[model samples]
Target: MFRYLASASAMALMTNGPVFAQEHDHDHEDVTLYRVFVGDHADAKVTAFDLTEPDRRWTFDTTGQSKLYAVDNGSAVVAVQSNDDAVHFFTSGISLHAHGDHADIEVTEPAAIDQSLTGPRPFHVIDHDGKVVINFDRGGYAEIIDGHELSHGELESTQLKQARAHHGYAAPIGDLWVTSVASDAPVEGDAAPSRVGLQAINADGAPAGDVATCTGIHGEAFSGAFLATGCDEGVLTVSDGSDGPIMKMLEYPDDLPTGESTGTLLGSKSMQVFLGNYGAKGLVVIDPVDEPHFRYVELPFRRVDFVLDAANARFGYVLTEDGSLHQLDLLNAEVTKSAKITEPYSMDGDWNDPRPRLAMAGDEIVMSDPNAGLVRRISSESLEEVGTVEVEGQPYNIAVAGGSGVDHGAEADEHEHEAHDHAHSHDHDSKIYQGYFDDAQIAERQLSDWAGDWQSVYPLLQDGVLDPVMEHKAENGDQSAEEYRAYYEIGYKTDIDRITIEGDAVTFYQAGKPLAAQYASDGFEVLTYAKGNRGVRFIFEKTGGDEAAPRFIQFSDHAIAPQDAGHYHLYWGDDRAALLEEVTNWPTYYPSSLDGAQIVKEMIAH
Candidate 1:
């Protein structure tokens, strides 16, 4: 079967037809699956669709119009209906598991978990470590639920209560809960209690530290080791300390203009940077660890909305009132690219008015255009319009789940953790594999095992003529056809179109130009994946060859014994250690005897 590429661990069990096989029907393989969830602007409904089959949609009703949040590492989504005082959970039905060398994917139908949480004004939802916290602004308490239990359809929560009801926020930080504080007294006719500062509390609802001064604290985000809360005066940062949670006030720089403070913040998952709004036409990049902490960036126009690329941490996307989507470089603090996306969305209307929202779906950026009643997909690398998904009502908020992972058959068993230790420990050693497999039929082999001429299948995929094969894989596997194509597009790119393996000699052909080398056995490495399955990589080092030839090459074709390879993924580089670290790009090849149509038939039949 076709394979998918991405990252993560499996959270739930889902069984289906035969294990995803290419030639060997019993051997399991990886596949990519991405899900997009959109909440309607005026209707009490949410719509979901896989990136592969956008035409096939799934809909669910809520108590009221809601805002969606992708929590629990994309396994589930939390829909918070503040006005209705209700929260709902739905599993995206896409789970990814990381084997030491690759990831496995499982895709199921998206459905509600049949659970709900109701409180007075359920507002901000925060997910940290393995916990999800829903702060009820009027209830004056935050509900903390284990992310694991949540994916399993449970609604139990440990309430972290405050002194009184207020428009506040709370998040799980290490072993303590960092919660916003309310004032002692409330003015007459006020909607809620006034927020004064922030305080840390234990898991048992007891105080862990004194309240830190943060007048009118609101926005909060986690970046690296720090959790920042936005304040009128500045930004309050909290991190784990040797003794307890440490709080620090990062006041606005002296050079920054007055009357401007961050009220909305977005944090990076890979870097220690925080991107926050600094008034209507400017942005602030907060470096929580270094000096000269606040770096301000001027915008082209008033910003409508902005989102960070969690997968690729160096960039962000900002939608301005000009109906333009601008790519922001977090590392350089500048606008790197821009493209007009929709009709101008003025910021003059009510703050809650429907507008465009941005979300990252794999390598593409998905934006909700409420006015157009469509969800637009933009290429992150090119910032160009690629495609669009139409919706009946205005599409307002969107949250994406699903990634790439291998799907071991229903009968597959969990791999021993010692396999991971073995892979890591033998990084520098020439021989890594040491009888990790229990089957007598699977054993180490010689260089003569897979000696033959091979051709690459990348050109066929690039021409977009393999839809039938993709559709077949989609029918048997859980994901859509387009998803499988996208997966191969990334995993099968290569300059060398042909390869010939004979005895101890290997020849790589680039445009009919051959670079041949003699290789010696360098042992094999066994890797444990997210599911209880494992894969093996046969290693070889160049003994005599042209200088242009790579010093090392590893071949993985779902085989470990002395047998011929029907097809294989090849990783070649000069650095033996770094080549093992590379997982995203694996140039694949098949027998030269197979023609284009035959290859597609082979894939479909497999």
Candidate 2:
């Protein structure tokens, strides 16, 4: 049956496939299933297609067009959360491909959990082993979905929440389940720990004790035998327990200042986890087996996207907005080399724009470039582009499962939680409000200077002049000033016209103008500028200034470089951001011809 699908796909490729020939033959044992699950832009529904063969041979649909965002195929059932607060589950095991020349795109017809989660929005939908965990602030609970059963359809929903919404995780061991406590405290960037206690679901599948509480790990996962949790101070490593899992904090060296890391991926082959630090784009490999130590490897570009392959622990791939794939060597602990797979994705606008994400299927390092609407399959060993497959919609995530596709029946350990609504009542043109005071000095009021709460992205914080981390004070999203500030708003009219979101980059046209942001080879520099080290800063050259030799205006450092200067935007601290401001303010302190004071006087007199 599978052979027919392959032949039909191959035959169809003869007419539509690229004229290019194979650089190398894919042997049989190398066969791996790489499913590119794409989510719609405005619709919120999801579609899945296979990459090993072209033509996307099959497809899977979601319930009521939820923003079919992330997937956890690890549990055999793929779950999608709707932007409308519906948690939908689908048996990934279906005869999706059907028989080649003809396609079933057989959808096992996704079913909505009878219990609506307290969510119009949910952040993370994770499944560890067979236990599925969902955290929805709108639902006002952290519900644990039972994965042990085949019929994931409403198996069980356990809600855990106290106040509004925040992100949490489920730590699943054989019989014991560790869930985060609910908290109402304001969270900055999905980095804060829950205030709720950690609940232990005993072997009997009952909530054993009261909220088991602590400043829980920012993110949790089972690394080999130890269930690991990330914290601001250090990591809390949980180990096997006769009764349940035990937790311990693994601190970094005192000299390291205990940098916090998130977006952790547990190793499938080793007891290691890959964490990207908020301070910079680097991987801190925590070797849990050995006395824990964070082996850091910094990449030139911020590690925007990453994937783990414990089998090939030697290296991992990072897809940066700069449009390049960095091959970071775990052993040497650095980005050894890089290759360009796509055009540069603009750093100009919105954060959720279609970007590529890297995932590994066995030894193959494949990247799903949603912007290009294609998958760039590279040879994991050679780091060379082997082939590219296009899937419609935005291929945001990819999950590989052992089973091809099936409709498994259902089973036990039912846990249910109260549901909530995650829908926000803000209008589409809602203005974004950043906090008042740039540098605690003045105001930058937008159309909201008078209108107040009924706004969005108001009094914009200009990204070019000042990079500020505005306070976020919103949740369960009531467009209140407090809630609106929790999210920042920036505007950019992008004309990514014809720019293929192919490899790591994109080439597009905006208003008939060509634009690109490829990776810079010359390493960038990190400078600290402000007092609390909280001031935001970056290396930016004014666009429309000069393309030949771009001039750089780094606020963190007092130095000004004209176009033709060669430098990269690496890292910068508050010190760099401030000291540069002080130096630039010299016209009031002391003057120099370089200060442009003389030119200003001449212009005024003229």
Q: Which candidate has the highest lDDT of all?
A: 1
The CA lDDT at 105 in model 1 is 59
TM-score of each: 0.67, 0.51
Off by over 4 Å in 1: 1-26, 99-101, 411-606
Question: In model 2, where is the ten-residue run with the lowest total lDDT?
Answer: 427-436
* TM-score leader: 1
lDDT string for model 2 (1-606, tens) is: 000111111211111111111001111011123444545544455665555655544554554434332223322344455355656655443222211111111124333334444464565555454356676744545566665343334456555443434456555654676666557666676564454445666533467545544464465554445566666556666665777666665666554534445445444323244444534455666666564467766667655577655334456677776888877766555777788888786645675666676766544676777777777788666678888877676666555432121111221112121111212121111000011113433222211111111101122222211122112111111123322222122111112212222222222234445544432212123222110011222243323322432233232111122111011112212243332322111101101111233222221121
For every candidate, C-alpha RMSD to the true structure in Å = 10.7, 28.8
Please report how far candidate 2 places residue 236 from its true position, in Å. 1.6
lDDT of 2: 0.41
The global C-alpha lDDT for each of the candidates, from Candidate 1 onward, is 0.74, 0.41
TM-score, candidate number 2:
0.51
Write the residue-wise lDDT of candidate 1 on 1-606 in tens digits: 111222211211111111133432234564656789999989999999977689878999999888999876676889999999999999878754433223445577888978799999999888776678899988878888777667556666788887777887888776677889988984688656677898888877688899899988889997766789889889999987867789999999887768988989987655668899998998888888786788888899999999987555678889999999999888778999899988999999898799999988766889999989999989887889999999889999899987654565553443211111112111211011211244444567777766788888888788776677777767655445775676566667898999999989999999999999999988887654322244577899999989899999898865566655566788898987667645556787877887778677666542
